[model samples]
Target: MLIVGLTGNIGSGKSSVARLLKEMGARVIDTDQVAREVVAPGTPGLQQIIDHFGTGVLNADGALDRPKMAQIVFNDTNALKRLNSIVHPAIRAQLLKAIADYRDNPDAPLMVIEAPLLIETQLFKLVDQVWMVTVDAKTQIQRVIKRDAVTAEQVSSRLAAQMPQEDKLPYAQRVIDNSGTPEATLQQVRQIWSDAIDRSQAQAE
Candidate 1:
């Protein structure tokens, strides 16, 4: 299978692009969703996190107090790393299983690993091609503010934690300009995926 790594800044429309790709027959794996799943109430991931972060970060019913954890990580760099250390590996394992299961089927032609931290976390190595979705910094800030319902300062701080758009360009084999309308983005991605899948098929043979 052609494993395409899809990534973008906080609100650059990676999920929307992934949704469009899924509609076009690509199997899409979302790491953020998988991370949440592994840590849901009755899981080992949840237990481990609780063990580390303590009950202060858990609800009365035992689900994670995401806001508490988010508040902790945003201001404390080490706390963010600790959280990632606890969650990223499990998510990676799950994502690998998903990729393997999909590839085992002869019919599986292409698949996508939709992850925000693909480049930052060095996940681009696993995929056949790395695609970065980009928008102007102003657009990114606007979208993220609306999406996260946070202040401009909050958005800027979060965006600053990762590598910039220009830095990602060197690593991205394909770039999707999501600065345009959703329809235009979808059109571009479909064309790119078609060409990318064709190349991957040729290489595998």
Candidate 2:
């Protein structure tokens, strides 16, 4: 299977692109979802997190208080780094397992690993190609503010934590500009899907 590493900074419309890929029959392994799984209520990952950050990070139901934790890490670079240290390894292991499973499945047309930190974590090395979704800074800021319901400052801090779009662009084998309308974005996705199919067939021949 062709493995496509999908990445972009905060508010870059990566999830939307991933959805389009799913609609086009790609098996997507979302690392952000995997990150949540590693820290579920009964897991050791949760215990370790509680040990480091205290019970304050958990909700009354014993679930991770994601918004509170985001507030904590968004302001503190050290706290964010520490959190990544705890969560990244577990996420990487699970992501690799997922990729392996998809690789073994003959019916999986393509495998797309959706990771926000793909460039920073060097996870792009695992894929056959990298597809980066990008948007203008103004659009990114607006989208983040609307989606996260956070202050512009908070969104800026979060975006600062990731690789800049300009830097990430050079690393991509394909770039999908999603700063326009949804229909336009979907049209780009369709073109990429067609190209991927052509490449797969050529390789088989």
Which candidate gets the maximum TM-score versus the true structure? 1
Clashing pairs in 2: none
Task: Give the CA lDDT, 0 to 100, for residue 172 in model 2.
Answer: 98
RMSD of 1: 1.7
C-alpha RMSD values across all candidates: 1.7, 1.9
Worst 10 residues of 2 by lDDT: 100-109
- TM-scores vs. true structure, each candidate: 0.92, 0.90
Q: Candidates' lDDT values, in order?
A: 0.86, 0.90
> Judged by lDDT against the true structure, how good is candidate 2?
0.90
Q: What digit string (tens of lDDT, one per residue) describes model 1 on residues 31-145?
A: 8899789889998888888888888999888899888889889788898888889888888888878777877873556788999889877788778789889898888889988
